[model samples]
Structures are given as structure tokens and as C-alpha cells.
Target: MNSEFTIAIHSLALLAYRPDHMATSDMIAHNVCTHPARVRKVMAMLRKNGYVAAKEGTGGGFILKCDPEQVTLAEMYRLTSMGSVKPGWCSGDAEQDCMIACNMATVMDQLYAGAEKQMIDYFGQWTIRDVLEQVRREQEKKPGV
Candidate 1:
């Protein structure tokens, strides 16, 4: 999987952790180890989808517009990235018709579709709050806070 989902979820979880404050793209990029621009791109998509609201000026940044408990991972996944799970087979030459090349694409398409559906269904089962809670619980079990 690409880093978009991880970035999106991590960014959201960070916001969820501090629902009262705004999260800047720079701060999010630092946490996710990506460029600020990438975070901005994802945040723009989230904002467009009504998941976040952007603020301008001095203390300006972004804040969650939707309830953490109501926001599902599946929703963010669909919003932030393209759904293609893997690359499909493609023949190098158009005239070089091969049975394997022709059949592989169809086979891969079905497999990818099934896998994508299962992933989306699994993500649909959890909300942002669930993920944040899980992370907090895991952190609590560590040697130190």
C-alpha cells in the first residue's frame, strides 16, 4: 500500500488527539515523515470532502469538521487516494497477442477487485476514534508514558 492512507489516518488521529486545536501541514508532515506539500494535498482533499475545515492567518491550520466517531477509515481511503491495489498485466506489443497476457489482466482485475472490496469492508468496521483509542491503549502498555 502507498503512504497516502497512512498519512491521512495519522494526520486525522493527530487531530483527533487534539480536537480543540488546529493541526498545521508542517506538523503533520513532521509526524508522518513526508513533505508539507504532500500533507497539504491530502488535507485539501479532506477539506473538500467536508472532513476538515481550513483556517487562515496567524494561528491558522486545519481542524476536524466531522466527529471522529463518525469518520470511517474507508471514507478517508476513498477520498485521499486512488483505489487501485496493484498493477495489471500489459502486453509490450499490441500485435503480439499472447494468451497469458490477455488472460492475466482479466484474472488480476478480478483478484484486485475482490481484495479491494475486502479491505474497504474491513476499514468500514472502524472509525477514527477506534484507531486513536487502540493507539492510546498500546502506548499505555509501554514501559513509560
Candidate 2:
């Protein structure tokens, strides 16, 4: 899968972790270890989808709009990375004379689609709050945390 999905989920989870549930793009980028522009790009998508809201000017940033428990990873995936698990280049050419080479692309496409659906369905069972809680649980097991 593309990094956008992870970025989106991480961004949301980070927001949920905050007591205020609000953070600037720079803050999120630091937490997620990415560029602010990337965070802004993904946050814009989330904002457009009504998962989060943006506030301008000083001391303003993104505010969580949806209930964390109600926002599933599946929704994030669909919003940021649906149909993205598949590779763009499959090892086949339809014009090739060999049967395997000619059809491998189509077969891989269908297989990837099925796999993505299964993954999304599995993600549907977990919400943003779950992710935040899981991270907290994982951190509790570590000394540095």
C-alpha cells in the first residue's frame, strides 16, 4: 500500500491522542516524522471528507470533527488509498504469444483487488480510537515510552 494511507491514519491517531484534539501541520509532521506539506495534503483530504476541520490564523490548525470511535481505519483507507494496493506494472503484455505472459497482468489485477477488499474489511473492524489505544498499549510495554 502507499504511504498516504499510513500518513492519514497516523495523523488522525496523533490528533486523537492529544487532550485538545487539535494540532498544526508542523506538529503532526514532527509526530509522524514527515514533511508538513505532506501532512497538509492528507489533512486537506480528511478535512474535505469531514473527518477533521481546519482553522486558519495564529494558534489554529486542524480540529477533530468526527468521533474517534466512529472513524474506522477502513474509512481512512477508502478516503486516502482505496484501490492503491495494486502495483501499476504487472508482469505481462496482452499482445504476447505466451498464455501465462499474456494473462498474468489481468490475473494479478483481480487477485490484488480481492486482497485489497479483504484488507479493507479487516480494517473496518478497527477505529481511530482503537489505533490510539493500541499505540498507548505498545508504548506501555517499552521502557522509553
Top TM-score model? 2
Residue 23's lDDT in candidate 2: 93
Each model's lDDT: 0.84, 0.90
Q: What is the lDDT of residue 46 in candidate 2?
A: 93
Candidate 2: how many backbone clashes?
0
TM-score per model over all chains: 0.88, 0.90
Instruction: Write one digit per residue (lDDT tens) for candidate 1, span 20-131.
Output: 9998899889988999999999889888888889998889999988899999998877775446585644433434478775576667667778898898889899999999
Best by lDDT: 2
Worst 10 residues of 1 by lDDT: 87-96
Stretches of candidate 1 off by over 4 Å are 88-99
Per residue, candidate 2 scores C-alpha lDDT tens digits across 1-145 of 7788999899888878774756999999998899999999999999999988898989899988889999999998898888888877779999999999999999999999999999999999999999999999998999977
Worst 10 residues of 2 by lDDT: 13-22
